[model samples]
Target: MTDRHNAFLSDMAEATRLTQSGRLGEATALIQRRLGVPGRSPDGASPADASAGPHAVPRLEGPAARLGTEAAAATAHEALIPERLRENIDQMMQGLRTLAPSLRGLVGGGLHAPKPGGLEPEGVETEGGQFVERSFSNAAGARDYKLFIPSPRSGPRPLLVMLHGCTQSPDDFAAGTRMNALAEEEGIYVVYPRQSSRANAQRCWNWFEPGDQGREMGEAGIVAGLVRAICTEHPIDRSRIYIAGLSAGGAAAANIARAYPDLFAGLGVHSGLAAGCARDLPSALSAMRVGAPGAAEPGGAAGFGAGSVTQNLRVPTIVFHGEGDGTVHPRNADAVLAQAGIDALTPRRERGSSGRHSYTRTRYADETGRVQVEAWSVQGAGHAWLGGSPEGSYTDPSGPDASRAMLDFFLGHSLPGGRG
Candidate 1:
């Protein structure tokens, strides 16, 4: 393995221990101190925004705090880090400093090979990017995944668990969002869990399939498996871990969040619907308009977080839909909110430019006091990434900086109670 990979694993392993051993607060303090709010990039972008740091992230208090945020540049400095935690994080980051040279990368996913100029692992560095691939087994068989690490100056950095939309590969999703590039600027780690195309046509995850929405058997297990792997293999601050996806991938992501709320700090849904809300495409479409079939009671549609959301967890969420979205109607966004039991609604705030309609966030509170529902309706957007990709389709790069805004939210929330 490359030195960068080795070092990243080491950090994650240590962080995992800290959080699992009930030292989450200490771990957070330790990580924050080491990475120190990431400095600006060579071209002068801005400080690397680590996933979970000192920010006003959404707070979902339950057995374990599991909520995140989408706030802007938060003002946290090295001075705020506790002395003891800083010392430990400093020591851990020192050895990995030498592995920066081996952190290059390759963009695009699925069956396509990385291009000639594409990033080469352990070679041409992109500021600094590090990641790890992992997997697990289920009744459906076995599955694998990837966890991109940001070489933070501070550590125990927050993590972003990215779920790819249907027919989309982790590599393609990474390319379009350039989230890894953003990680360099923000000093946060990015985790990309790929859904096997063999499982569904069009390479879409079985989010609409009931088997995938449950806690034990299908897609939910795969997602939970990835989370478990990350917890076992990295120094991810449990309170700061977040999830996001597009299209069917977005729907899968929402399902994962609602099903495993304890596992995700926050969630971002782009061009997708809530899973198990319907059994098929036709029913899924109908549920998107109103509530799930027979879900007419006040809390009828809000029960998706009972297990699949993450071992019966409740976390913050951010949903994105295009008013003109043809594939998945904008109404689906509402269906997602209702099903997740999110009751708060932020006032309508929108802005339009050129061919884009940008709908702002209206916060909805969940039973745990966390903002359960937050939606971003891109009036003219489509069933694709807001930002464009070189080899990826169904993306609109010219639109709002979805990656940036998503990161802002990712950094905004924290895990309830604390993981370490």
Candidate 2:
């Protein structure tokens, strides 16, 4: 295997030993410090309130302390990794032999091709909206997309751009989120952009890459260009344009919103890290595990430690995250708000339930009493889309309808002088 993969294996093996010896805290801290993300703790705990060294491991408490390291790590999904590795050792070895030649990507879920398939139908033909397949090419690159036109409208209508997660296509995402159906009801247009496998094997947006993170370049630039083209071709209101996504797609949405503040009026991120949270594969792994280092602090004007959002113009944003998410830490939800430059503002918090899950909703408002940011923290939810359909992958239909909530929030805000 290559040196990078070899190094990762060696480091993880050592971490396994540390867990076996009831040194879970040390193991987590070791990995974080070694990987250059020492701000997070053993159990993906936020470090905003902790006063410790970057390499310091916080002591476990109560039940976790009593259970020792093994149970703790197991509950956190870190312990099963070794077992999974052992079970797939033979296949993994064989794949590793040919991976160097077949795979040109090492990051953004490129280590393996877990989900195998190409494009599928956007939805049933009876869905009522025209889900047309289209393509857009710009100076940066070319991408294929599916646009859902909501019948014929008299005046300009709102438009929403939806980005899919890693290993997901526009069809699966549209089916899962059921956004097209909602678009027909709200009289708004929706678009789903397809990520090319050539860019990343898993079809994940390269949000962790520096080239893709900047304005007017890379993936962000292509997405922005697509939006502009859609606006020019369709009767879309310039004031009410918005974008939302899940996982890697959510990260890309944040980057796109930050880069082109004038193009998008609102942003939505579900189970995603903030833009600039990771610069490469190692940091991306670290951020997904614990969170971006220094994300614990919510009151930062200089963009969280790992992210950089320098625009004085803030894009109104709404965020959703499950507290029990193991793939991406819940702390990342907070980092998203901070990166949007709204975490410094005090929020009005409320508690509610969606029958299946209890959630905490926090809203931040400007001095004029207009809400600029909203966050939802769902309890007992994992790494799936809340209230999404099972027809698509990575969806849990057990929580509040995220599509409805996001649509309402998006409709509530518009550009400074445009119609809301």
Candidate 3:
């Protein structure tokens, strides 16, 4: 076996040992560090820097090795060893050994094969609006993000905060959703806060980590600070501020909406789990694989911290999920809806078609007839942005336009106290 493969095996063995010794946290952290996952460090250190300390291990090389590392890392915390992990490792090893020279060349060159449709065209600067690169820094840490200001900007415009999925960039997400185009039409300001690869190798928001889940700490605080910074710099309507995301980003959005209900008028979560669904890497994997039970209620004195109580407010929410999604189970959408505190109400269901995808949409309303929650189940869509452009990554072009629907729902709601 190659030296890289040997190192991969060594790390896996060590992680398994650590977990067996009840050092689940350390084992998980080791895996994340070895796999180059970002934001695992507490002091805002880069993964490379954090991994370079005394406990750091050698890095695994090649895509197959990386995949093996992730699988092995995941198995460390399991009460019983999973047969699937071994099977996957064996399959990957055999596949890597048999890979053609041409394919190997492509992999070595960063897997930069041009995607179909070329959604992210080369040399394209801006489209339908202006994209300004900005940074927000506070006590929690500094993060870089992009802000899209539509043309003919006037008045206190509504602000939409969008979080991208794992391994996706703000630009890719913007292209897929075409949110900027819609924002231009509606005269809205859109912000896409990028989750750095230095923070998580997958460029995913660390929503599953307990540190990033609560208010005024970790990533949640940084994101909220970014919002406050934007509002202070621009003429944004605080009462109409909204947040939405897909996958990991979607989960983070839900966490933020839950922790800081007063800051967001509405939230959109597409293929995401409910807030506090998972507090560790193992639980997160379980939640993603099989879906977790929904939270008891939106707000009932039980807050993120033991003593603090979350505000008694429910932000209007919209959820979209594909029944065919293999990455994240469809039941996660149901859990998110339940977390919005809309399970008691009967939903108004409607069947709709967009592009080549058919979907059923259900809306839950309050006693005042205000729609509090909406859920969309796309029949044949997979783990992707519904009705998104093909040019972007992990997007399904056939489903109903989730971006438009989410925006409509967001625009209809405002903070109860009209923004603090």
Output the lDDT of residue 188, model 3. Answer: 91
Candidate rank order under TM-score: 2, 3, 1
Question: Which stretch of 10 consecutive residues in model 2 shows the poorest summed lDDT?
Answer: 55-64
Per-residue lDDT of candidate 3, residues 1-420 (tens digit)? 688775555455444544443445445555555554445464223444454421122121112222333344345423222456545544543443354334423322211222232111112224466765555678776676778877655578899999988767788789989898899999899999987644676667887777887888888998888898778766888999999998888988988888788899999998877777776676677768887643434444232342111222367889999888777788777678767777556689999888888899999988878788999999988788887887676688777899999999999989765573
Give a tens-digit lDDT track for model 1, residues 1-420: 787665445444444434443435434443553354335332112243223221112111121111221111122323454677557655754533443223212221211222232221222223367554444554544555565767645556777878776545666678777888888788777877766534553456766667777665577777676566556555667788788887777777877776666777888888776556655555655654443543424434434434222122345667777676666666667656565555444344445453455555566654455455566767566666775554454577656667787888778788777552
Q: What is the C-alpha lDDT of each candidate?
A: 0.57, 0.72, 0.70
Candidate 2 accuracy as lDDT: 0.72
Predicted structure 2: clash tally: 0
Error of 2 at 387 (Å): 0.8
Total backbone collisions for each predicted model: 53, 0, 6
Q: Is candidate 1 or candidate 2 better by lDDT?
A: 2
lDDT of 2 by residue, 61-131 (tens): 11112233334443443442455443454354344445543332322111222111222223222345576
Superior by TM-score: candidate 1 or candidate 3: 3
Instruction: Show model 2 residue runs off by greater than 4 Å.
Output: 1-127, 298-313, 417-420
Query: In model 2, what is the error at residue 75, expressed in angstroms?
Result: 40
For model 1, the run of ten residues with the poorest summed lDDT? 54-63
Which should have the higher TM-score, number 1 or number 2? Answer: 2
The prediction achieving the highest lDDT against the true structure is: 2
